[model samples]
Target: MLLDKSVNHDEVLLRTLAGRNFYASIQTVVKQKSDGQLLLYGIIEDISERKHAEQVINELNETLMKRAQELESVNKELEAFSYSVSHDLRAPLRALDGFSRILLDEYQDRLDDKAKDRLSRIRKAAQTMSGLIDDLLQLSRITRVELTVKPVNLSQLATDIIVELQKEASEHQVSCIIQDNVTALGDAKLLRIVLVNLLGNAWKFTRNTDQAVIEFGVRSSETESTTIYYVRDNGAGFDMAYADKLFKAFQRLHSANEFPGTGIGLATVYRIILKHSGRIWAQSEIGQGACFYFTLGK
Candidate 1:
């Protein structure tokens, strides 16, 4: 047992002879006490599987990080695009509406009756377009606003809104009976818009009836856990076939001559309801009546 070199013989020198994992050899420089000689030393083991696993894990993490970065970039781009459309596009529409109205008023004598009517129509369309653009801007803003659940007095709100509407009435006998103790958690301003649009639509559509009847109150549904309040009206109700398209942007069931609107009202209502975590739906038939039911989250 004479040796002149030291080696870690734990793995049986797996790289020396045949370089196998289970069996191996070791070379060394050894000399007796009289003479000295030397030999090469080699020791290796198979760790290929473990190294491959580590490489795969590192590659997976890299791919996941890149995917997350891409999603974040997409989100930022959408926000910037919304800002551009809402902020930049409405400036020219305002100018168009303002100038048309100004020309009509200041140059009344310069335009004949038909010409003036056409000009008036143009101004009306422009103003309507402006209103539509404003609604779109509002819709965009609604998406970004943080909503909170606060006490909303639906009864008082309905009464106030209805009284305001009645102020503009000439010969329409439309009244509201807002049930007492109808308060809930919702955005008051947005809820007011919901009331305004729903009730205003009711009032406008019922223009042809000899006596317009509209009501606002809560009604029980077997399916819902919350009290569903609805604005019911005897009006020019639409066909059920178009009901599915009712809440979409720029979708109008009636022509501008019959019932004029920019078709953004229902879309606004839908957005407001969604923001409140509520639901809204309408039931109507041609010339019967329409009812809009909505409820805020509890």
Candidate 2:
């Protein structure tokens, strides 16, 4: 075919007579000389390795796409199951809590001391179980909600949350330091949840300190355009050995007697940050207090 053409460039995958594959790029040029004789030039370069690499990449891409689809399907099923479980338990919890409260209010005068105490215990247990149910639902919702990303004034958010916390616990005299103009790009709602959990933990752990101090700020990274935000507190810090369990669902570093919680807040925060393509970590010493650091990807 090249012998009949004046000038041509083509790439061909050829099977040699020896029965092996070879990819070759061919360039040909032909011109009529002054004496009516033809001049022919041809160049052929082997491109087998490049073609093989492209084939391998295409195969890898197909496999990755299939895996991604499967993961998405599995995640949807898990979310549905969580929703069902939480919904089923909520009705019973509400009934128990409502009945216990009613019995205590209407029958306290007729009931004995032991009976009243038993009713009180039932009420408290019902309330705690209700809280756990709510936390499970919240975790599931956060995991499944679509994120709405925008510029958020993180410092202002922290200040708002701190003010609310102070109002709720007016007896506690704590000093809070929030850096001005600290900001980031993320889902404002989800970021608020993260701050609420982190700041709430700081506040809870600091209850034993006479004059608790909490700080919220951002530090510039040396080699990246991203900022690292942190919440620090002078409080009852936990052992570093248990740090790995901090973000798992229903894992608590501190006992409920010391810090009353459903052990789901950190797990929720972790999911929110992960949805934002971010990272979160903590540093602490038993008595010196703790600092939590996080980054929202730019």
TM-score of each candidate? 0.72, 0.76
Error of 1 at 290 (Å): 0.2
Candidate 2 colliding pairs: none
RMSD of each: 8.4, 4.3
What overall lDDT, based on C-alpha atoms, would model 1 receive against the true structure? 0.80
lDDT of 2 at 192: 97
Local accuracy by lDDT, each model: 0.80, 0.90
Candidate topping lDDT? 2
lDDT of 2 by residue, 1-298 (tens): 4334654448898787899989988787876678877778888778899888999999999999999999999998988788788768778878887898899899989989898889888888989988888888889899788999899999999999999999999988789999999988999999999999999999999999988999999866788677889999999998999999999999999889888999999999999999989999999999889999998874
For model 1, give the 10-residue run with minimal summed lDDT: 7-16
- Candidate 1 — which residues are off by over 4 angstroms? 1-91, 221-224
